[model samples]
Target: MWISWMIIAVMVGIECVEAGLNTLTKVAMTSGMSDFVFVVYSNSLALLFLLPSTLIYHRIFLLGLLSCTAQILLYTGIGFSSPTVASAMTGLIPAFTFVLALITRMEKLDLKVKSSQAKSIGTIVSIVGAYIVIFYQGPPIMFSQSLPILHSPSESPLSNWIIGGFLLATSSFVISVLYIVQTWIIKDYPAEMVVTLIARVFVAILSAIIALIVESDPKAWTLRPDMELVTIVYSAFLMVTIRSVIHAWACRTKGPVFVTTFRPLGMVFAVFMGVTFLKDTLHVGSVIGAIIIALGLYSVMWGKAKEVEIIENSFICRINSSSEEVPLLQNKSIDV
Candidate 1:
């Protein structure tokens, strides 16, 4: 019971960290920090921390490539949209991973089982909630009259929202694929830290190259001594290194779907961050969608727990049956 609670707490903590990251990154970008440059700098700084203990494998490059691509997409989306949108889009990950896992045969589907049925229902519900958040904007709710320092214009253009939503959705899908591949790699290597380090190294190199090309002005790479520097360091230490290591460990222990199950939790955290720090207007549709997403998240988590319990009970029954058979054979041999 304690272990289950610990897992839940840790997952919640990770989501909080992710929401904070998005908030900070958005603030820094609003201060004129190039998204591409930010990715390169933070990742490069992370490489320095990870370099102390490093092992290389050629196949791990794919992991790095995917990571870089996803980060670029996510940050770019945040530039165009709000952190709330980015967090909301993450709710799609479990649904995406569930489908990918089934396709890859990593997960089994048996509609007859209540657990599987719950998971299926939860996936559909989650996707519906996500789209509702995307398509519906009923009314904006303001918490305070004062505008935040980091807040952008009163309203972002609709085009930007559409583009950002598309990019964020794409990023989530890529992450789902990465989770599947990472799980496969971990099964063979079984070294979470080393795997993560190798992947980060690749991300740093690739992102640096892309940043150089996209940000032609040399001044764009220069970090200011203010929030720009702070965001980079925070992102490097907490997000790039610590978050990646924790996630890799979680993915090793629990399946990819389990790791992604907590994504909706980030929406709650993001809403808090946006309202307090960013002073982002809360929309009725967003509130409704987030609540629905949370419900779906709970349903999926319950289904996963039930499935685990069923597997464990079945294993215990098999062991008991074998033990009983052993005693019966011993009695038959003695009688003979």
Candidate 2:
């Protein structure tokens, strides 16, 4: 149990780092490069860093396919939408994962089961909160800026950006599927090496495709002595490779739900950093939505805890029954 708590702590820490890296990546991409170029370069660098590990593990194919597909969709969505919007949409990943797991019968749902009930209610609540965050524009707060810092003085209309936000949300859904599949694979495989290797290979292929499509200029390949490039490298090598390895290790030690529960912790950290460092204005509705999200996250965790208890008890009972049967069989043979 102590070890489990430690693993969860590590997962939360990793997620926090991920949020920071993601925030930095968005800033870097806004510099000059096309979104496609940023995606390609980021993935390529990650692949280069992870190649050796993948070769060592020999699970290059499976991991590569899954990671590449997910990353491609994720990057494409990011290219289309605001980072904040994208992050908010990604908050729905847990709900998507839960629904998928239920559909596949990987998870059982019963009204009589308190955990299941909690999870169901939590998922619905979190989704509702997300919609409120996205669609609601309450009375202008005192701090409400006339213009968003991220947007140019002459920016596109909000209605025009709806498609981009929707694309990002769809990307989040696809990512959740990949995460679920990866979790299932990790049950039988060494997750660290497998995930690292696959990410490297798949991202390599993905980057090459993006480069061919968007970066026709040879100058795009030239390395610039820019801080943004450094941030991208850090995101690729440390955030993608090192942190991911740690996350997989934690998941193996603690279970996927234990790791997943800490996801919202990232959002909390992101909000804090955004307000402090980026000077992003927060609205009353956004604050309320965030609180609701936290509540929903807690509910999901509660449900998952109950599910884990049920599974543990079932395993214990089976083990005890098997032990009893073995002793009885041995006693009968001795009498004979």
C-alpha TM-score for every candidate? 0.92, 0.83
Tens digit per residue, CA lDDT, model 2, 210-314 = 668767887776666674688668778877778767766755655454455555555556655565656666666666777887788778768877887989999
Prediction 1 global C-alpha lDDT: 0.85
What tens-digit string does per-residue lDDT give for candidate 1 at 142-252? Answer: 655534545453378889988998999999999999999999888788887789888988999999999988998999988799999999998898888988887787777
Instruction: State each model's CA lDDT, in order.
Output: 0.85, 0.66
> What total of clashing residue pairs does each candidate reach?
0, 2
Best by TM-score: 1
